[model samples]
Target chain A: MILPYYIIIPLLAAFLISLIAGKKDNWAVILSVIATTALLVLSLFSFISMKDETVTYSMSAWSLPYGIVLVQDALTSFILVMVSIISFTSLIFSIQYIRHLSMDWKYYSLFMLLVTGMNGVIITGDFFNLYVFMEIALFSAFALVAYGSRAEEFEAAFKYAVMGSVSSFLILAGIAVTYSATSTLTMAKVAEVLPTNDQKVIFWIGALFMAGFGLKAAAMPFHAWLPDAHSSAPAPISSMLSGVLIKALGIYVLIRIFYNVFNAPEIFTKIFLVLGTISIIIGVFLAIGQWDMKRLLAYHSISQIGYILLGMGIATPLGILGAVFHLFNHAIFKSLLFYNAGSVEMALGTRDLRKMGNLMKILPTTSQTSLIASLSISGIPPFNGFFSKLIIIIAALQAGLPWYAVFAIIGSLLTLASFMKVQRYGFKGETTVESVENKVGWRMNTAMIILAVLCIATSLMVVPGIQEVTLDPVVKVIADKTEYIQLVLGGMNGN
Target chain B: MQQNDGMTLIVKTVTRISVWMILLYGIYIIFHGHLSPGGGFAGGVIIALALLNVLLAFGRKFTSEWLNISFLHDLESASATLFLVIGILGISLGGAFLANFMNKGELFALLSAGTILTLNIFIGIKVGMSLFLVVWVLAGSKIVKGE
Candidate 1:
């Protein structure tokens, strides 16, 4: 029942916002806030109440094979909570940011649909259902990226659309092959059936899915569209895109399929290791060269995601733990950084580091949050990112991959250097920025502050006692491969 | 033949009758969708095509005068909302989300599948309105014209 509502509430909010919210957009803002708030509360409740249990809801009273299932397991709940929290703050941020662009209700509607799509992806147990929800999320994403309607915005949206379509086609073909091979669309059933069949189809499915979701995740090889699309989007949207969208659509699916479904085959693990290392090295190098503030953060999103993938690729208990924990931490701090970039852009009308200077006083909240997020991204001790990256690096070394560990260490140092450049040039440059064309509103600052606090608070997730409850359960889900099949198939108590 | 006048008079005359027939046929297809191959989506496209036919034959001016854009927008939103609500309503009434809670009517009857028929109607309305609105906006946009 609760699983269905995660998608239903936001979908209803999207349609109802369009239905009721007029030209003023007051109603649109109110409804989006309410909807996201409700989702955040609901997802938090689900995460707490069902700490380790798997709950599945079969649509229309149909059983496993015929019906599409919505599952709320530890992994699903963790991702859902990440999405809800980020979306709630993003909406609060959007209230002011989007108003400055235009007092349009369409933005709110599209945002709700975006949430609905992510929630659906997280909740659905059927492969085809996940595809449908992803399409919903992407359609809105394409529109939102083009909302600014600048020539570059159009250019970015066009590039993103082409990349998205090609990935989607590959995914669809993969699904077709999977279905033909397994004779089922339900993921658990597919898991049960896939192993009994030929291993070659499994390799094809893994490769296609790796490339497809890899593109969506913006892995190094398939990362061409990400910087443009993520940076070209409106600010709150940029935060959402970098923070949760790629995680939900790309990394979460990657983990679920490769680990839970396919059970972490050696070849894909090697593929993941090479790709993750390359992304870690190359993404930071690409990030180091960016002058555009949002573009810098966007490229860093690629770099940060590299850490998570490396953690997953390592495929140890500690490594999966690091990946999951870093997934949460990156969502918090990356979103905060985007908020800083957005606020700076809002205040000064430029995203170029050269154009920005001495904003520490003028935009105190944004600057301080930027500092926390910067230190967090750079793996400074006591912040969440440090612990996760340390775990990932340590896990890499422990797993007998010292060279990859050294590369990660190098990536971390480069990241620190890159962010140091940001702090020096973008926020604390010698020149004083005098006039603010538009002041950063309280709501935007409040959103930034919320994430900044979470940057520190969520690091507690790795604390031994708390880790046992929160991060440990999720890691257990990913670590025990065939357990997902039993947990999902064994728990089909639909409402 | 003339700018914004649409097609020739002969074509207009032929479209005048054909458009209404298309509209009627689309409704028939949508209503019969639960039992037939052509469902809500196909029928809705047909319904939009009927309006598009008028646009091509009679012109933008005539179509704009005859229909309200905002109303079409509202219709689209309302039907989509109704479609979703109908699904949730099935759950509230008892079984599961999107359960066919209502009594299944006689086999081959016009009112057969309980929730599917209602869902089809709503989806039909939504798709038809949205498609027409999309055509309307694209035709009207300066950016689309590259001007």
Candidate 2:
């Protein structure tokens, strides 16, 4: 019953903000903060309550496979908690970040709508419903990207919109093909019927889904729009887009469909492996040369996603666990890094690394938190990122795929090099230009500090008991295809 | 003859007569959406088109006099809130979210389909007001640039 309110709360807040915030910008901030905080508490409560069981709520009491259903399995709950945390922090950060912008109310409204879309994507149990929610997230993101109304922002938004619509069409085509083959739009039912379908047709549908979701995830060949779109958007928006949007809407669905829905076929695994390796190498090499701060981070997003995909491609228990854990860690540290970048931009009014120097002197909080994030992202020891990457590497070796392990290691090294460049040019030199002496806002510092602490705290999930309670269920949901099928369709068979 | 900002006298007069008919037809489509093909989205677009007709017939000056932008904005938000409230109502009645709580009247009745009628009306109003606001803002921007 609480499942729908996850979506309804943000949506209602969006409308209310639009109605009242035009004359009073503070109302918009207050409403959005309250809404996101509520969502965080709700998601945490739902996660605890449904720890070991799956809960399915059918819309309109039309029964499974007929009406839309909201399913809260282990995987959905895990992602829900991750998304709510990141979105709440980003909303809090936006309260002060958007103060000087025109149409501030609209920014809050679109931000809430984006959260609604992502939550809707996570909980939906139907294929078409997933597409609808994906559109919601995508459309809001497009608007948010263009919110700055600069020439570069508009160009980036246009490119993103065009490419995104193509991906949507591909996803729609894949959905149509799946319905024609399986005669059902429900995810669990599709999984149930998929094994009986023709292998060739299923393979073709897999290819379509890979291309579509890969585009959304900004994988190697399909990643032209990410750097521009991420770098050009406003800072808080950049955090949201880079932090959780790509994971929730793209990689999360891809993993769900490939592993749970299609049972992780050999050919698909091979494709994922190859794509993951290419994205890792290309993304790192491309990132090493950029001087623009956000663009560089945007490229690293591609590289980090490659690591997660490689982990998934290994197709083992440890591999799945590592991938899910890495996904969670990346959401935290990456958003922390973006928030750090936003603080720097707010204080200095520039994103160019060549022009920034000696930031450790004035902006102590920004520099320290960014250093933590940079180390975390680069997989330094004792941080959450290191454990996940080490697990993925070990899983790859255990799976007898040493070459993928080698690439993962190399990607981490290159990630370290790129961040070192960011630190050297952006924070460790003499003041390149006159320091603005602009004070960082308390709200922005608070959000970044919280996330920086989380980057270290989340590493505790590696403990056996915590891992059993948290990551084990998500891993089981992805690893055991039969569990998903039984959970969604077994009720009909009275099993 | 002097030139006006909008269309000619004949076009304005015809638009004035036809817009009300379009509005009525849109309302009919919305109310009968549960029994027929047209529903909230299609009917809402029709209503938006009728408002657009009014905008085209009368210039910005005339339209701005009565069709306040902020009022339309508020209407859009209110209607959206109304639709969400209807969904929440289902939860309070010991059912799932959006569980269709009301009793179904007889077939072919105007009040059939528990929450669908109320939902359609809200959607119609939301879509109509939002579209009108979009057009007004776009037109206002052009005027600003022209001046």
Candidate 3:
């Protein structure tokens, strides 16, 4: 019952805004904010209350095997919390940041649609339904990427669309193959039936999905579109894309499919390891070379995603724990980092690191919060990023993959180096502070501060008692894969 | 009204009679969707084509009075909203999202499939309006610039 509202609220907000909100965007803002806030509250409630439960809501009252079901386990709830929190803050940020581009209701409507798609993806248990929701998210993302309407923005959007289409088709193809092989659309039923089928079928599906979702996740091989699309969008949108979208549409789906549905096949997990390593090393090197502030941040998104992938690929209990924790932590600090980039971009009228001067005296909140975010991303202590990365490194070493751990450590060092460049040339360039084009608004600053606060606060998830209540359940969901079959099928009261 | 309103007289004359017939045929398909292959989507495309036919033969000037972008947009949005409302209504009345709240009626009958029929009507309206709106905005006006 509570499950559908996650989608219904944002979807209703989107249509209601489109239907009623006029050229002016005040109503749109009110509707979207209310919707997102409600979602945030609902997801948090579910995350706390349903920590140990596997609740499923069968759509249209059809039994499992025939109907699309919405499942909420620890993993779903955790990702739900991440999506809602980021979207809520991003909405606040957008109320101001998007105004710099245009004061149109269209942005809010599209924004709500994006939220709807991601929430729908997180909740649905049917593969076809997931693909539909993914398309909804992708379409809105393409439109939003081109929201600026500059030539370069359009070019980036075009590139993203082309890549997005190819990936979507691959996903659709994977779905078709799965449906044909297993004769079921429900994930649990498919999982039950897949083992009896030929082993090669699973490989083809895994390969197809990895190529498809891997492109969406922007892993090393399929990472061309991330920088342009993320950098080209407006600031708050940049945050949403980097901080939440890839993780939601990319990593979340990958985890659910690879871990839960496919039961973490060794071959695919091996692929994840290789992809993760390449993305980590190459992405940071690419980041250090970029002069564009947003572009550099975009490259870092690829690298940080690599960290999450590395954690997930390790597949041990601690590795999965680290992956899940890092997913949330990266979402917080990365969003904060993008907000900093956006605020700075607005004030300085540039995203070039060399073009920026010291912003310490001006835009104090952005610089300070950015310092926290940078330190967090660099795996400095007292912030959540360090703890999650340490867990992954330890897990790798524990699993007898010392070389992988070394690579991860090297990746962490490259990340620190890259962000140091962001700090140095971006905020402390020799160029003196001069007249600024824009002033950071309170709404945007408030949004940034919320995530910045979370950057430090979410580290509490790792505390012993808190970890049992929160992170433990989520990791158990991924680690003990067989439990998913029972949970989705009639073993638990999903209602 | 003018000599240069649209295409040849035969096309205009044919369009005046054919558009309504096309719309009538589309309505038939939508209402019979639960029993037939052509449901909301196919019928809706036909309906949009009917209106597009009007614009083709009579030009934008003739359609400007009752047919416009915003009107179609509102219609599309209103129908989609209704469609969602029907689905949500299922939760309140039938215990699940998009459940068949109303009596499903007898199979192979015109009124069967309960909410699906009503849902189809709204989908048809939305799809038709949306398709027409797309064409209207993209190439609805005069081809020559400065219209």
Candidate 4:
């Protein structure tokens, strides 16, 4: 029952904001806050209810595999929680961040639409529905990237939109091929029938899906547009893009389709591993040279995503667990880092680390929170990043892939060095320019503080009881492929 | 009367006569969408084209009086909301979201296909308004060039 609200609330709020917000800018902010808060509560409730079993809702009372359905399993619930938390915080941060920009109401409306699209992507059970939601997210993100309307922003948005549309076309092509092969659009039914199909055709579909989703995920060879798009957008939007958009639209869908629908083959696993390794090494090498603060963080996003992919590539129970955990942790810390970059830009009017010095003296809250996020991202102990990285390495070794574990460690070290440059150039040195006092808004500070706390708290999920309650079900769903088919198809037959 | 703002008098005169015909055709297509080849989107685009013809013939100042961009924006939002509300009505009526609750009616009547007609009407209004606003914004931005 609550599944529909996940999409309806944000959608309704977007339209309502558009209708009334022209009269008063504050109404957009207030209404968005209320809408996001409701989403957070609903997602938490859904997550709790979906702990033990899967809940499927058939649209228009049509039987499963026929009507558009929304299925909430442990994996969907986990992502729902991640998206709502980050979006709610980003909205709070934007309350202050967007005030200086023109057309704030339009910003809010598009932001809600983006949320609605992401939620739709996460919850929809059909491939065509997924494509529709993906476009909704992509189009809104394109507009949001160009929200500043600078020449550079426009250029970046154009590049992103072109690449995004190309990827979408590839996905549609893949779906066309898939439907032709299996004669069905439902994911579980497709998965069930896919095994008996032609191996050559299956291979082609897998290749297309990998390329399509890899571009969206910003994997190594397909990562040209991310640095620009991530750096050019306003800070909160940047955080949202890096934090959840790439995950929900790119990596999560790839994992769901490949793991659940296609049943991970050895060849695809090898492809994932190679792509993951390349992105990890290349992304960091690119980051270390960047002078701009947000650009560096953007590059690091590619690198961290490489870690998650590597974990997925390992394809062991522990590996999947590590990957899922890293996905959640990255959402928290990466958004926090982007928020820090935003605060720096807000105060100093520049993103070049070359121009910044000793911000810890003035912006105590911002600096400390940034330090926490940086350490967490760099895999320091007692932070969430460390545990997830540890699990991935151990899982890889357990899967008899010591070399891959070595590559994971190498990526972590490079991440540490790159962030060290950030700490030294952006926060540690004495003020180079005459120090100007700028008052950081309480709303912005509060959002950062909340994420910082989450960075520490999420580490507790490594505990036995917590892991069982929160992550185990998701791991089971992914690792045990037959159960997924049985659950979805069985529900349909019962109906 | 030599009007400097608009196009030639012949184009203006022709547009004045054909615009109403185009609008009438658009409405016909929208209302009969349940039984016809052209539905809400095509009809809505036709309606937008009619308005665009008016703008082309009469110029900005003349059309600005009736087709205000902000009003079009509001209408787009309102129609979109109305669409969602209709979907919600299906849920309230004990069906799934977007379930066809209204009577199927006789094969091809104007009053047939309860929700489809209403939905088509909403989509036509929303699409027409959105296209109009897009054109207006693009034209308006072009006029402000040297800023």
When just chain B is superposed on the true chain B, each candidate scores a TM-score of: 0.91, 0.91, 0.91, 0.91
Query: What is candidate 3's TM-score against the reference?
Result: 0.97
Error of 2 at A96 (Å): 1.1
- Per-residue C-alpha lDDT of model 3 across residues B1-147, encoded as one tens digit per residue: 654987889998898899999999999999999997999998999999999998888888787664766868878878888888998999999899999988889989888888999999999998998888788777744454331
Worst lDDT run of 10 residues, candidate 1 chain A, spans: A486-495
Per-residue error at A242 for model 4, in Å? 0.5
Q: Estimate candidate 4's RMSD in Å.
A: 1.6
DockQ values per model: 0.83, 0.75, 0.80, 0.76
Q: Candidate 3: where is the Cα deviation over 4 Å?
A: A491-495, B140-147
Query: Scoring model 1 with DockQ, what do you get?
Result: 0.83
Each model's Cα RMSD: 1.5, 2.0, 2.1, 1.6
Report the TM-score for the A-chain of model 3. 0.98
TM-score of 2: 0.97
lDDT per residue, candidate 3, A111-172, as tens digits?
99999999999998999999999999999999999999778898899999999999999999
Candidate number achieving the greatest TM-score relative to the actual structure: 1
Specify the highest-lDDT model's number.
Answer: 1
- How are the candidates ranked when ordered by lDDT, highest leading? 1, 4, 3, 2
Please list the residue runs of candidate 2 whose C-alpha ends up more than 4 Å from where it truly belongs after superposition. A432-434, A491-495, B1-3, B143-147
Give residue A129's lDDT in candidate 2 (0 to 100).
Answer: 94
Cα TM-score per model: 0.98, 0.97, 0.97, 0.97
Q: Which stretches of candidate 4 lie over 4 Å from their true place?
A: A432-438, B143-147
Report the Cα lDDT for residue A359, model 1.
97
Q: Given candidate 1, what's the lDDT at residue B140?
A: 83
Candidate number 2, chain A TM-score: 0.98
* Candidate 3: pairs in clash: A56-A494, A293-A351
lDDT (CA) for every model shown?
0.92, 0.89, 0.90, 0.90
i-RMS, every candidate?
A: 1.0, 1.4, 0.6, 1.3
